[model samples]
Target chain A: MSAAATLIAAALGIAAASVLALVSFPARSVLVVAVNALLGLPPVVIGLVFYLLLSHSGPLGWLDLLFSPAAMVAAQAALAAPIICALVHRSLERSWAEFGPPLRILGASRLRALPVLLGMNRRAIATAILAGFGRCLSEVGAVLMVGGNIAGHTRSLTTSVVLQTSMGNLETALLLGLVLVGVSVAVSAGGIALGGARL
Target chain B: MRKLSLSLAVLLALGGAAQAESIVLASTTSVDNSGLLAKILPVFTKATGIEVKVIAQGTGQALATAAHGDADLVLVHDPDAEAKFIAEGHGILKREIAWNDFLFVGPKSDPAGIAGTHDAVAALAAISSKHAAFVTRGDTSGTDAAEKRLWKKAGINPAGADWYRDIGGGMGAALNAAAAMNAMVFTDRGTWLSFQNKRDLVALVEGDASFINRYDVIQLNPVLHPNVKIEPARKLAEWLAGPDGQREIGAVAQGGEQLFHPDADKVYVPGT
Candidate 1:
């Protein structure tokens, strides 16, 4: 369940960054600043706000998002998008600063610069996605708030580990912990591989 | 230098003495939020002079803490898990101390029209069939466990239902979610009374056999770990179930409302 959520978050992050990068003025710079500030937003607070929005009395209560995987995905996406965008933005900004003069010297048009910018920051974008995935995979508070930890449905690896540990199932919790570590490692490796292929 | 060293040694000795034979007690937030511990523990301290540090988590987590020996004693409400803990030999000398009822509260709109239905299962079914939003304490707390039992009794699986929302959080948080969502929830009467932001929710279905929630005090079995502080733990448990303990439990208040009715006689029946 967590794996699927992380995949969704990664896709969301990329899509969000792409939109922000294409539409905004001084796009990379704006994204970098916004993402850096958003990185500090507490996960618990995010969960609480979403909890209200999705609850029955809240305006969006009709959506019935509370305690669903969709709610968890929304939380993970909110948490991951900024960091992913920021990293990609920074990478693009730095690449622009370094390559702008050279590209101009080579008679490159402004139109040609966009693809060059993306190519140079391919690894940075992958790193951003990986970071977002890591944050979503391990988060307890947001998931707990939004997902409701239903055993077969909303429960994720982190929440399960906490639950198992609390239930005095140390061995199960430890095994789950190991699985979390493996997932993290696999995600990082995948990110690097994908970034390498892109570059 | 010798005089300074002597004073330092004296300070260290005094600090250790001040620390005394302290034991950790993990209990339900209902007890903590109700201010029962403050009234009761002083009596135990006066009698045994053993200091106790209370850590409040949900009943599920409280039992889990005792299972890991993270706490010397546990006071929680989930009967099935409590029985399982004792059966697993993680706890010993368990006894009921108090009980309260669970209330099904929801928006005054009463979308499900569950009011007066004394059957909790039927009420839940009505709420589900009507697709009225229901907030569940998905945190696996005792309330969550009871909610699950009710859902099962209703012959409906709420897991993937669009209206059954699981906010995997403590009772208070879950109640808050229910209130904000204008959704129905099953909560301990104690937490519901103390909850400040109930919005427009009111108690819809209550006073049923299934609504009875009992709390127990148990000392972790010293047999499991020889290092367990059995004597102090026993002292605390005994004190809690005794006269002074009952008084303390009865006296706990929130907004001038008594939070729990301590059943020292253990004669408090569930359904009646």
Candidate 2:
């Protein structure tokens, strides 16, 4: 359940970042800094805020999402979205500067310029997705707070590793930890492959 | 200059001599959060002169830490897992120290209407049939394992659909999530009473035969790692099962409510 939720969150984050990258913004440095700063926000803090918003006492508690995968996804998305968006933003900005004069001289419209910019920075976008996946897969604090780790239901590889490790089940914990590492490595390899394909 | 150098050397030697050997104890969050160690450990130090460091984690993690010899001793609940540890030769000389029961807590309105059911399986099934919100501690802790067993006994698959929610976390966090959602959740009574976010939720079901939760203390076998402080670890475990430690365990408090009952005298045979 956690794996599925994390995958959904990664997809949402990448899509949101792609849109943010496409939209024109002034003061590129400020936008990049704002997004980058959000990348460092603690997962537990995000979990806490979500708990407040979705708990019975909170405004949106009616949604009944306090311990659900939805809550986990929301928390992960909050953690990953900004980082993904910032990476894509930086990539597009650099690529745009490189391609700007030539496209303008060729009489290309802003609409035409977007695809060209995206094509140039596709590697950066893939890297951004990989970064988001890494954040989602390995996170313990937020998932522990929001998802509630209910075995067979909400347990993720990382949480399983933590729980098993705590319970003295080193064999199972090590197995889970290795799997988590494998997932991360696979995501990184995919990112590299995607970047290489673009080149 | 020579006299100053000698004085500095003496100070460094004194500092080195004062350094204590640290023994890591992996224990439950309930014991850690209740501030019990602060009250208890100083006395142990005074008597034994060995500084003990407590690393608080859930039962699962505590057991795993001991298995790896990352910790010298483990204090945790969940008998089946503890037995597995003993059988696997990761731990030795397990002793019962304290116990508490699991409680079903939900919103005051009782959306699932399981208020008085003594049968945990029946209560879970009713909650599912009603399609009311239910919070699960999906984090694979002992409480989570117990919850899964209840659902299995009830013959209901708790995944899928909007009614069942998995909050992958510890008991306290899971309880808070249940309280927040006004969803029914299975939690240890100790954590339920100590939890700070018990606003709209109250204990709806408890005192069933199936709700007993026991905590145990055991030392990691020094045979696994010769460097492990097995002597002190065994002493701590023995102390926990002895009268003094049992007394200490029975005396833990939250708002004047006793959080656990010391069960050192009880023999725990699995599947009983």
> Each model's interface RMSD (Å)?
22.7, 22.5
What CAPRI-style quality would you assign to candidate 2?
Answer: incorrect
lDDT of 1 by residue, B43-68 (tens): 77787778876766788877865665
Residues A1-199 of candidate 2: C-alpha lDDT, one tens digit per residue: 3344334444555455555555566775566567788878888898878766765446775554544556676677678777777777777767667877789799987668877787776777667767877888788888776665544434668877765543334577788888889878987887787677755
Each model's chain A TM-score:
0.82, 0.83
Tens-digit per-residue lDDT, B108-182, candidate 2:
999888897788888887898899999887765677777888888889997875989987766666666776788
Off by over 4 Å in 2: A1-199, B1-19, B266-272
Model 1 chain A weakest lDDT span, ten residues long? A1-10
Error of 2 at A70 (Å): 37
Please report the candidate that would top lDDT against the real structure: 1
In candidate 1, which residue pairs get closer than 3 Å at backbone N, Cα or C atoms, i.e. clash? Answer: A55-B181, A56-B181, A57-B181, A57-B182, A148-B168
